[model samples]
Target: MLDLLNDLLWGKVLIGLLIAVGIGFTLGSRFVQFRYFGRMFRILGASQAFKRDKHGHLSSFQALLLSVAGRVGGGNIAGVAVAITLGGPGAIFWMWLVGLMGMATSYLECTLAQAYKTAQPDGTYRGGPAYYIARGLGQRWKWLAALYSVLLLVTFGFGFTALQSYAVATSFDDAFGIPVVFTGLGMAVIVGLIIFGGIKRIARVAEVLVPVMAVGYLLIAVVVLGMNLPRIPEVFLLIVNSAFGLEPAIGGSIGAAIMMGVKRGLFSNEAGLGSAPNVAAVAYVPHPANQGIVQAFSVFLDTLVICSATAFIILLSGAYDPASGADIGGVALTQVSLADHVGEWGRSFVSVALLLFGFSTILYNYYLGENSLNFFSESNVTLFNLFRIAVVVLCAWGAMTDLGTVFAFADVTMGFLALANLIALLMLFKPGLRIMRDFDEQIRAGIRHPVFDAKKFADLDIDPAAWEIEPEDIERLKRYGAPPPSASQPVK
Candidate 1:
């Protein structure tokens, strides 16, 4: 059954759709992901508003951390390793390309998320692909929203939750001989404690842990790369040459590289996966474009930075051979590569990284499922909790079972959800473009403190005073440079 589902989900139809959607977003936005690539970092570095702009929600940084918590997972390690094993080094190029294009997809989805966000009675916000798809795409097409909710609840909460648990449990057991059941139970307890506290607690935990884990891994990768410095240029040449079916470096055809890269890269950053947008919606910022900008940077961090770090370390270590050996797959391959450089301790460290990375992803995935459940029934909080707990148990089972089946099942479900989300995003691409234009206008006008509140629902009763833009903010905006349409433009 799982094999059949895999065949159907990953068949040419879905693969074509995924690629087409990515290109469509890139073309529709005129490759805004690239045009604004530098601006993304500039805005993040220079914006006092992004730093201090909190409206009773997570700061832009914290929201970004929350999004990163999911993207920077075992996929960077085990999944990337698997892509190389299955698709070869050339796959790395495709992954990078997909990630680049994915930034725009992330921006578009996040913009829509903010555009359709609904405030909760408890003074918080909730919105996601479903909300944007329904509201932005129009009420009549709400079935797309409903379908996404159901797919995520099962795929993420139930399916991928299990996969994450398995990664944690298996890594520990492989590294330290700890019982799998013990690991699973302990993880369940930790996750339950956090899920019960809601998004605030999740954000608090992620803000600290994501940075630590990402920096620590990058540091380790740098050390490994330093040790293999002489091989760096050759390894990169191989990745590029193989991407175009050049015969010398990679023995395999270029098609393998493209397929593997697309599959693994899309899985890595999850730009169009519809997962990150759920987290993006929770942010309390003035403009959806603010969070959208942050999310674009996240795709860069996930694939360009984190995933690349892992790929380079593995490739440069001289651990893999494309010609002779069978493909070394999953966390085990990463362990072997790291161990070759840093010894047995390296393996253990990868295990710990896997646990932290996978655990964070599980928590974020459950939160997405909870929101998906919320869309189905506002009063089903208890049921949502119950379903979430069940995910922990599934995670346990995932660790002790045949992961091929589990992974294949997850792909089927996630691919379906991603397709549904991509459709919604494409349908609402115009709204995202409009928001970007509005933000650009505000920036050019020297409107630093532009009012960000735009209500989608007529029933939503917002107080005018709460959303008023201040003149002082306009002065502050001047510091960032007059936005494109504003007369404060630097006199050329």
Candidate 2:
């Protein structure tokens, strides 16, 4: 049943919808993701990017790291390997294409999220597809918003977290002979500790750990690639040829490549899946597009950089044979490939890297659930506490469950979640474009840093408090050469 459902969703319905929506968003935004690619890094490094007057609000950079933490997980490592195993080396080509198109989709959805974000009573912001659908589209769409929230809670809150925990436990078990149960229990305890500390603590941990783990993994992949420099061209040719069915290797059908690549690509970067926007909306950016641009870059980092690293490691090592029918796949394939390159230590390194990647993702996934719960009821302490406990328990339970079952379940839920968000994105397309245009107009007018003025968008249902500028802050912006607060711009 799971396989049948997955085939229907990934092979038929989602593949077309995802590509169409991605192309639509890209065209609608005039390819904003690529046009502002360089600006992404600049926005992250800008001094204003770190400003947060509220105690609980995340800086843009922190939010980027948090979203990246959620993105660069087992999907980059194990999921990449799965794509190769089931869809052939050609599947990677599809993954690359999806990542590129996803950049635009990510920008649109994330910008809308920031625009519709609500100012919570606790001095923080909360929003996502649910918030945008409800608030941006008005009272008629609240049910759709609620549905998206429920899908989010089930997909990221429970499903993805459990799957991540299982990945970590399996890797540890394979590497150190640790009991899966023991590893699961330990992870559950740690997850409970950090999640209880709230979003700030999660942000702090992501800020420190995401960069370290991602860089470390990439460094090792670089070493493997360097060792196989001569075969570099061969690997590229193989992926391209296999993707088109010109090279008839195992699992090399063009259809399989497209299906697997897109499935795994969405799984890895989550650009259009409504997941990252949860974190994206939490950032304190001068303009919604600033964070949107920052997040578009994350898709590139996850799929083009990190995931490609894992793929190259496996392909270049000559450890993975397309014709081999061996049961070794997923993290095992990655571990074996690295071990073949470096030695037994390579295997241990992958286990450790996966542990860190999966752990950070669990933290990120938990926050998404928490954010969704807040959407339903912000002040329900008992309910929130119970949800936290459920998260911890699910983390442990995930470790002990069958890996295939967990992954299958996650994929189904993720498909539905993405479907909801994509529908909302299509409906709210013009508003998103309007927000992007506001940022673009400011930039063209020579504003060094664009500030969102809620009054300018009074026609939209944005939360005024969320975008309100303090008098002191306005003065501070003027000192930095930002334009003064002015009357509403003519709505296009």
Candidate 3:
């Protein structure tokens, strides 16, 4: 029943909707993701992108890091291996194409998120598909918002936390012989500390650790790939040929390759699934599209950079077997491939990497669920707090319990969440494009620091507080060329 539902939701329904919406956004925005690609690096390089610009909150770049933290987890390693293993090397091409198209989907969803975000009591922000569906669509459509929130709560808050903790526990147990129970408790403690500190701490930690871990992992992949430089062409041919059914050894047909590629790629980067926008909306940027551009770059980093690293490491090492690919998945394939290429130490590295990757992802997932709960009732501390406690408990349980059921539950819920989110994205696409155009016109006029004026968008049913500039912060930004003190946190 679970498998049937998943096939129906993801394979039969979402594949077309996902790609269509992505292509639509890409065209609607006139390929803003590409035209603004270089500006992504410029914004990232300047502190304006990372420092607060709106009410004191996470910066645009920090929000990107937060979203990337969610995107970069163990899936980059194990998931890529599974895609190539089952889908054939051809699946890599599909993943790349989805990553490209999904960039626009991510942009449109996040732009709406930023435009509709609510100012939280603690000077932080919270929003996502739910917030946008309500504010962007209308008050009457709030039920759809509530529906998306519920699905997000179930999938990320409960289901994914367990899955992540399970990965961490199993990896640590395999690597250091730490008992799953012990690892679970320790993991829970670390998570409790950070989440208790709220979004500020989560963003701080992501800014520091995410970049370090991602760069280190990629450096290692580069070295391994460098060693196999001669076979690079062969592996490339396999991935490309296998995708189109030109290579019979990799799979049975082109459809299988496309399905596996799109499925895993969509799942891995979460381009249009509505998850990243939860973090995206928290960023303090001059224009809503600023964060959208940053989030689109994140898709590139996740699928193109991190996921591709895993694929190359596996294929380049000659460790992946298409004949037995069905059995190759998750941590096992990653561990085996790295161990074969770089010595047994590579296996231990992967284990440690998975532990960090899964744990960071769990942190981000907690925030997503917490944000969902906030949408229901910001005044109800008891409920969202209770959900957080539940998340911590489930994280530990996921580490020790049989996860077959949990994984299945996660899949079904995620499929539904994507369905809800994609619908909202399509409906809200035009307004989102307008916001993007506003930002683009500013850039075209050579405005280095393009500030958004909410008055212009008064026609939209938006929370004015989101775009209102605090009076004191204006002079401070003019004087120092950075945002006010509230925007800067104590660096981790």
Report the number of the highest-TM-score candidate.
2
What TM-score against the true fold does each predicted structure earn? Answer: 0.89, 0.95, 0.93
CA deviation > 4 Å runs, candidate 1: 42-55, 249-251, 401-404, 448-492
Task: Give lDDT tens digits, candidate 2, residues 1-492.
Answer: 888987887777877787888899899889998889998876876635345554455778988999999999888999999999989999999999999999998998899999999876665688899999998888998998898889889888988888888878988998999999999999999999998888888988898999999999999999998899999999999999988898866665788888899889987888778999999998876688988999999999999999999999999886897666677889899999999999989999999999999999999999999988888998588887998999999989999998687678878888888888888888988988998998898889988778888887878888878876556656666765678876662111
Give the TM-score comparing model 3 with the true structure, all chains together: 0.93
Ranking by TM-score: 2, 3, 1
Clashing pairs in 3: 89-239, 90-243
Candidates sorted on lDDT, descending? 2, 3, 1
Residue pairs whose backbone atoms clash in candidate 2:
none
Residue-wise C-alpha lDDT for candidate 1, range 191-223, written one tens digit per residue = 888878888888889978899899999999999
lDDT per residue (tens digit) for residues 1-492 in model 3: 999998898888999999999999889889988999988876666545337544456677788889999999978888887777677788889999999999999989888999888877666787899988988888889899999999998899988999899888988888889999999988888888788777888998998889888998999899988889999999888888888778876743688789889988999999889999999998876668778889999999999989999888888775677675456566788888888899989988998888778888999999998988888888477886687688779877888987998898799999989999999888887898889888877777766555666667878777767765656545544453433323322111
**Which candidate model has the greater TM-score, 1 or 2?**
2
Q: lDDT winner among the candidates?
A: 2
RMSD of each candidate? 4.7, 2.6, 3.9
Q: Compare candidates 1 and 3 on lDDT and give the better one.
A: 3
Q: How accurate is candidate 2 locally (lDDT)?
A: 0.87
Return whichever of 2 and 3 wins on TM-score: 2
